[model samples]
Target: MIQTILLKQRPTGRPKISDFEFITEESDLTLKKDEMLLETVYVSVDPYLRGRMSDAKSYVDPFKINKPIYSGSIAKVIASKHNKFNEGDYVSGMLDWKTKQISNGNGLIKVDATKAPLSAYLGVLGMTGLTAYLGLTEIGQPKTGETLVVSGAAGAVGSIVGQIGKILGLNVIGIAGTDEKVNMITSEFGFDHGINYNSSTNMNAAIKKVATSGVDIYFDNVGGPISDAVLFNINKFARMIICGAISVYNNTELPQSVSVQPFLIKNSALMQGFIISNFSEKFPEAINQLATWLADGKLTYTETIVEGFENIPKAFIDLFDGKNKGKMIVRI
Candidate 1:
């Protein structure tokens, strides 16, 4: 029997651990011509999961009732019924949140832990990694000596974005929800400056103080009032990349949309929002660069790991509440 976590119903507010049920399932060796049984090691819980909860039009489908929830997970092929993944091979792919998963070997890809940590394949070196790379590279387009601002600055994707901006010769100012988060971002993630949104008496003043002149590139993760504050300091021709809005993820009603349209008109700013899935063609390049950086110590990642199958929903809830430091994951 394998322990698994399954979605029960659409949640209206904060998702408790009980929102997801931990149950046992029978395992079978029955295989198609090409298949494998994978043992999950780490499962990523992201803000994107909240979007999947609503029965709204989006990139992915809503989680069906009674179905096991699946997300990007790092796993090892324990028993192979397929030629693609042999037994004992490490891989990272979308897998059910459980002890073991049976797959037909389609989207699964081999993970090279000799180059980076296995858990990294679920975070900085995975889909979230790709999203950070693509959104910044394609939209942010920071130049030398330019000022860059990253919201949710201590997160899996935001931290990487800020690090990359520093590498590209930009002064990176990050906005996080807490003081500890601010400390980690500047001390650990190589950001030039960091602001704690929660403590800022006047957020606009705090942003203008750290960013000095103005923000040249904005990599936004937690949008809302924080974004509005940054939007007030945008430099001419500034670029903003909207990836995930962790701030509004748990809101029952539509969030109050701020009129930043004026910033675009005033600064000639280019603000483009993107879903990571749109960059499929660029995954290989992203993975290689992220892996190289990880091995070279130029990139670092932190994960808030919750052990056991039943805690998946709580891990997700923590993400929106900013209770997590970096990538939020469930260890199975």
Candidate 2:
């Protein structure tokens, strides 16, 4: 039997576990020539899944109702009819929320479990890592001695961004939702400063206090009021990378806020939004560099794992609650 989670209803605000329905069925796992049957090991629960739940237009297509939701999943080949994949080989791809699947090896990347942990392919050595690398280097164009401010600093992408900032000799300031996460960013991730956005009444002042010289690059993960605050501190020719907007992902409308275009124009700052796929052609280069850094111990990461496949939806919901320290993954 294969267990799968179906999106039972479109959510209004923060999603509830009730919005998801789990079902089990006798999956006749079969493979034709050039195909492989996979058994899921780790399921990734990311913030972007929230956008997919809505029927509205976005970078990725909305997940269909009554069908299994799909994201990055690390699986082991239980049976293979393909020459490229052998039984017991590990692979990662955009597989379903179900426990089992069949694929023709397209879009599936063979993972060397010996090089890194299986879950790393879904995180640090995977899309999240690529997102941080591409956004920071290619877009942010960070330079030594400049200030880099990253919101959702303790998250999957932001945490890595901070560490990479330090490696590049930038003054890295991270903004997280909780005190514990604030401490983790500063004490563990080598960030220059950490601000607890939840505790601070004056977010703009808090950002200014740490970033005395002004922000040279801003890696925005959670948009909304936090982003509004960061805009007040951009340096001339600064770059702002719009990564994720978890803060307003559930909003029914595009909430209005104070205009930031004036600040951008006055400072000649650039703000650009990107889907990780924009740099797909260069993924191998970034992935290899990230791996080298991880191997050399220059980079560090954390994962919050939920123990069961049935807990995938709960793990995803926890992201908005700011319950995770780094990447959130579900171990199947």
> Tens digits of per-residue lDDT for model 2 on 1-332?
88889999888888999999999999768778899898999999999999999975653689988989999999999999999999999998899898888889889989999999999999999999999999999999988999999999999999999999999999999999888999999999999999999899999999999999999999999999999999999999999999999999988887777698899899999999978988899899999999999999999999998899989999999999888879999999
Question: For candidate 1, lDDT tens digit of each residue in 128-194?
Answer: 7888888988788767999989999988889889888877888999999888999999999889898
Q: Give the root-mean-square deviation of each candidate in angstroms.
A: 1.6, 1.0
User: What is residue 73's positional error in candidate 1, in angstroms?
Assistant: 0.2
CA lDDT, every model vs. true structure: 0.84, 0.93
How does candidate 2 fare on TM-score? Answer: 0.98
Per-residue lDDT of 332 in model 2:
93
Question: Among all windows of ten consecutive residues in candidate 1, which has the lowest summed lDDT?
Answer: 51-60
Candidate 2 residue runs with Cα over 4 Å from true position? 57-59
